[model samples]
Target: MKPVNIGFNNMVMDERIVAIINPDSAPSRRLREEAKLENRLIDATLGKKTKTLIITDSNHVIMSAINPETISLRIGKGE
Candidate 1:
């Protein structure tokens, strides 16, 4: 599977990603919390603040320091 670099050398399977969302939304925050509670939150931000929330097909929420718009653009480039 093609990989999308989410920053700090962290990568996620492109095809497995369901949505790339900003963390500012109410629903997005709730989803992140739920993922944390469920132990399905993947923190790829290292020590930086999370800017994007990558929801995967397996209900996993991958947190990244990169902006959502930048990440979405990276998706189309197929790196």
Candidate 2:
């Protein structure tokens, strides 16, 4: 699997990622809350403010401090 760096030394499998969203959005917030309730949330923010929410095909939600645009760029470059 190709892994892409999301930031702060964090990397996620590129193929498994279904969506990268801004954390401030209402839908994203709800998604996070649901993921938390389902125990499918993975905190990758490392105590920093969350900038992006990564939704995976396996139903895992990852919080990242890095912006979604930056992560998209990394994915575009296949890094």
Candidate 3:
């Protein structure tokens, strides 16, 4: 991924910035297993409250879960 320029309006000095980058690697068996478990949980729960974000590298390898709902809430608050 690339650092997206947000123009000068909101730009400020000394502000921390974050970026997401993907690399080349195959999905690990452990990740596949976890996803399968999560899927089963969702299915068993009948999608009562299910949210999963599996961000993988360029080669579809699971890197790490950034954040779940807290991140969503932060973005929502920013908006």
For TM-score, the strongest prediction is: 1
lDDT of 2 by residue, 1-79 (tens): 7899988888999999999999897998999999999999999888999999999999999999998899999999999
Candidate 2 overall Cα lDDT vs. reference?
A: 0.93
Per-model TM values vs. the true structure: 0.95, 0.94, 0.21
List the candidates ranked by lDDT, beginning with the highest.
Answer: 1, 2, 3
lDDT of 1: 0.93
- Candidate 3's C-alpha runs over 4 A off are 1-66
Candidate that beats the other on TM-score, 1 or 3, i.e. the better one: 1
In candidate 1, how many Å is residue 36 off? 0.5
RMSD of 1: 0.7
lDDT of 1 at 55: 95
Q: Higher lDDT: candidate 1 or 3?
A: 1
| CA lDDT, every model vs. true structure | 0.93, 0.93, 0.30
- Write down the worst ten-residue block by lDDT for model 1: 70-79
Error of 2 at 22 (Å): 0.9
Error of 2 at 23 (Å): 1.1
Clash pairs, candidate 2, are none
